[model samples]
Target: MATTNFDCIVVGSGNAGSCAALAAKDSGCSRVLILDKCPPDWVGGNGYFTAGAHRTVHGGLADLLPIVRNVSPGSDLASTIDMDPYTAEDFTGDIMRLGGGRSDPGLVKTLVENSRDAVQWLHDRVRTPFTFSFNRQAYLVDGRQKFWGGMVLSTDNGGKGVIDAHQKALNEAGVEIWFDTPAIEFILEEEAIVGVVARRDGQAVRLAAPAVVLASGGYESSREMRGKYLGPGWERAKVRGTPYNTGDGLALARSVGAKLTGDFAGCHSTCWDFDAAADTGDRLLSNQYTKSGYPLGLMVNSNGLRFVDEGEDFRNYTYAKFGREIMNQPGGCAWQVWDSKTTSWLRDEEYGDGVVRKVWANTLEELAETLAEDGLQDKAQFLDTIHTYNLAVDAFVQQHPTTKWDPAVKDDLSTHSLPLPKSNWALPITSPPFLAVKVTCGITFTFGGLAIDPDTAGVLSEETGKPITGLFCTGELVGGLFYGNYPGGSGLTAGAVFGIKAGREAAKLARRL
Candidate 1:
């Protein structure tokens, strides 16, 4: 404990914590320290497992070309692309709408307003490897690269690349990060946080800091917490990120009388590979375990029924909540079936050569039989569901011959006369060589967390209904931005936004102290 003091101490060394630490240093904090409960391998925490999809408001392709390394303006490739400008209204509306109007307006506004700036800051200041998410966002349709869904940016090499950039930036900033050190509690003096008590090398060490930022992720990793808060059967959902994000910071903050907010029973979940690890995410595979191709086809549960409107919206908007619907099925799992015409469109990262065990057959009957072996309990009903779905598509196309099937946008190529009609991009399953992939729910992060002041990112007090002096929070730890559902890519954007705010404010508080 030679220098047992710092201007600011950040708990958790994930994307949010790293962002806060960098912002603190850049904002004039001389000594900033980061503490993580995980070992060195989990350096970036859940950020290490992210797909690095960064959703931000931008002026379409022209605005993004400067920060991205994938494509350049005036190129032949650029001429073949179609990208629509995304405004703050689009971003704000998406979060509030998807979250069922439960997201805090102040927090959502703060997040949406600063989103583009945060992306630019990440590129310019952190030297993050930015690239157009062509593989995930855009698709080639008739020699045109059309971008859909409002998300267009991702780090090269996904989460690994994002974390690598943070590591380099942290090293340059000289921020000392202590791995395998878990913050057990905060030192509160006269009802204001003054320091942190953490277990370092199996010893209790007290580190002095006028401001402490809690960015230690959420309770998604703890099966107990999941079962307790997120309702029944969530404990069985596959963990899509770091195992260390077990609500440690939430507990630490609550121990000091922090107010909890957001929908405790809700979370960001998705269709994960059925065969994926149940307890933790695979570092090597990372977000590849996600099976989001359901938006391109149809999904049937164990009873062999189409449970959701696959084309309810862009995959980005609907994927998070669909996982919970899958869990609600009879067996708590489902199968995504696509035909030869659309199977090729599935991203290589998710359904390519060896991403997961895939079932293939030249006929629908054989496909159903194959899936039955893997968990399709009602093969006869599965065949009937496909038959009825194909009939509806044929009827719709016959009535509206002008409509074209385009995956890049919601072209309204829908099904007709069905109890649960697919809204758009609906095509007949007539192509041979069908494919089916089994999937289960993958929990990303718990939405429940500490209530924070939207302006300064300070943790709010439960008793006083005010900001706790010298105590701040960011990332998944500081919630109230999401509820029943979440907008894809907003997680990282929200984290960076509040992380920067927390850092700057905490640095000011630290200097004053």
Candidate 2:
């Protein structure tokens, strides 16, 4: 066996690990080696899958109040737990409440207090330009604007985008990078992490470092881990991101007594795919369900029945809802039905064109026939549901004079100013070539792994709940922060915040060592 030495060894080159490396270099730490199982091309992990929304309270809570009020309109900002002062006390309280009281309070406090500085450091020192999406423009949380600006993107021009920028900055600052090297296990002496055993080029290499950072993403790519931790149904769900996130880093950390949290926090929802072969390259490439003000649309199980409300936030309990009603159906999938009106609207809408290409159908019967061909469901049951839905639409429209026949009225995407003519606008599926497309539950990121102190960004002992000397963890590896509920783009915000802290702290420790 061969051995290598460095002041610090950071495993997993996603947002956290990359930022940590950059920070360590900036903190005057030399000889830092950042190892990742995947290359820079896929460095973002699930961050690449994100719409790039960020929630932060850089200013005091008072300044953020207006943003929050604007985001969740008609809702009392002060009544929301996140609206409290952005102090360490209030932030920790908010995390515990959002985590259903299961989160480590100490870690949550650190994350909240340090989050603003982290955002500022990334924007000012690291120069990672953040952007906002039009859809999330007004959304706010805890008095801070959710998204700072349009698509807060990195100025680095390349295939890797922000990930590449972080990596490049680390390299320029003298940090070494090892690609295709997977950290298989940790070297523990007297119950303290001292080094790691890694696999590189089909050989095991023991790398010794006083400090280790595990930023290796979650277990979404591993069917075995997903089944064991998430649930049995997740074994069948489509993994939408990097295939390299097999959770080896997480398993190794846990083996060394690191606590795990939020194992159940993962995005589960119906996503369009032209075929099983179409699973590659941007999972939402074929989504036909348009996002207006709401998830205005219809979802039919293989049996051709509306299973759940499309407006239901898929990030929350939508997957669990589908598991109970749609997963075990005829084809283990579902179909989305829309009409020409929706087709035209989607084309004209901002996020519509990309989703419209997913649907297929020439007529009501033809759409059902096409679904049958795709092996998604029984044509007869699907046709029957369409009939029932049509009758309901007609009756509802007749009862309401100013009504329009659109099945997606419930998810009315129309602006608030343009209220629907009727409360229920059920469009008839009588048009020729009715459109339908196959949809499967897709995962965004895996939310489980090594536990760390949210404040110090240090790896904690699972039993004693104290920091492990010379070891730090951040990003998806830091468990218990999110618990079960994800507050939209908080994943990126959390990673950036903790990554900067971990890097600075690790560098300081290495200097003393």
Per-residue error for 324 in candidate 1, Å, reads 0.6
10 residues in a row with least lDDT, candidate 2 = 413-422
**Tens digit per residue, CA lDDT, model 1, 1-513:** 543889999998878888999999999899999998889998988888888999999998889999988788899998998999999999999998998898999999999999999999999999989988889889999999998989989989998998999999999999999999999978889999999889999999989998999999999999899989988888789999898889988889889999999989988899999999988899999999999998789999998899999999999899889889998998789999999889889999999878988888999999888877777899999999999999999999899999998898998999858999999989888898888899999988888899999999999999998999999999998778998888788888888999999999989987785
- Over the stretch 324-370, how does candidate 2's per-residue lDDT look in tens digits? 23444545577767666554433332234444345566767767766
lDDT of 2 at 474: 80
What's the lDDT for residue 462 in model 1? Answer: 97
Model 1, runs deviating above 4 Å: 1-3
lDDT, candidates in the order shown:
0.90, 0.59
RMSD of 1: 1.2
Q: Pick the candidate with the highest TM-score.
A: 1
Candidate 1 residue-wise lDDT at 320 = 88
Q: Which stretches of candidate 2 lie over 4 Å from their true place?
A: 1-3, 39-41, 58-113, 135-160, 264-294, 313-330, 344-357, 360-362, 384-434
